[model samples]
Target: MKSGLTVRSDNYADVLDALNKLSGTDVLVGIPAGPPREDSPLSNAEIGYLQSTGATVEIDGEIVTLPPRPFLDMGIEDSRDKTTARLKLAAQAALEGNSGMAEQHLEAAGQIARD
Candidate 1:
């Protein structure tokens, strides 16, 4: 389907130019939670520039007003760590035969994982 920022070239400069052409539009930028890596498609600097253009940014389903550098990285790591810890707790609860507690912990884990 045709979506936002459609362009005709695969070059980085072309893609960026197309994005820049989107000025004055209410853009919704959705970024998944994850640590930045060398091979990431877009650098944190680029994301910050995009946000500076007044685009509404959503990280892991929550709307945020900050740039996408340290803030997004921290949020991603925090959410991942919480999800892992909750999953461990759920397993421990199950081992203790506390089915109710295990279920609750598992539900919490799911929510955090989604984030």
Candidate 2:
């Protein structure tokens, strides 16, 4: 039962490392949604939400009405083609068993998404 079967794992470490980084981890674009920072009155996400959905508030005893803009939605929709190419590259890298390269591609895609 001792057949000489040699297994090569030259890229195993890199692949594992890359998988750890890739699994359940992804880039998020746009303002983060959360409460305001300690020093700020509003988070960027709050501002964006208000702008996208519109709101009415009473300021100094006067009622002010805001209009819906949906800028974030428009931006995400517009960037569809921009990041698709990079994501495809990442997929190719993964298929070729080059995990490190795949991670790079994913990073590039994230950057494109952010941009």
Count the clashes in each prediction.
0, 0
The list of candidate 1 runs beyond 4 A from truth reads 1-78
Compared with the true structure, what per-residue lDDT tens digits does model 2 show for residues 24-78? 5676777878878787677878878888999996667899999999887787678
lDDT of 1: 0.57
Would you estimate the TM-scores of all the predictions? Answer: 0.33, 0.66
**C-alpha lDDT values of all predictions:** 0.57, 0.76
Question: Which is the leading candidate under TM-score?
Answer: 2
Summarize candidate 1's per-residue lDDT along 1-115 as a digit string, tens digits. 7568866645565434433433222312235435555775556656655654545667778997764344544554668778779867766665555556666776777666445
The collision pairs in model 2 are none
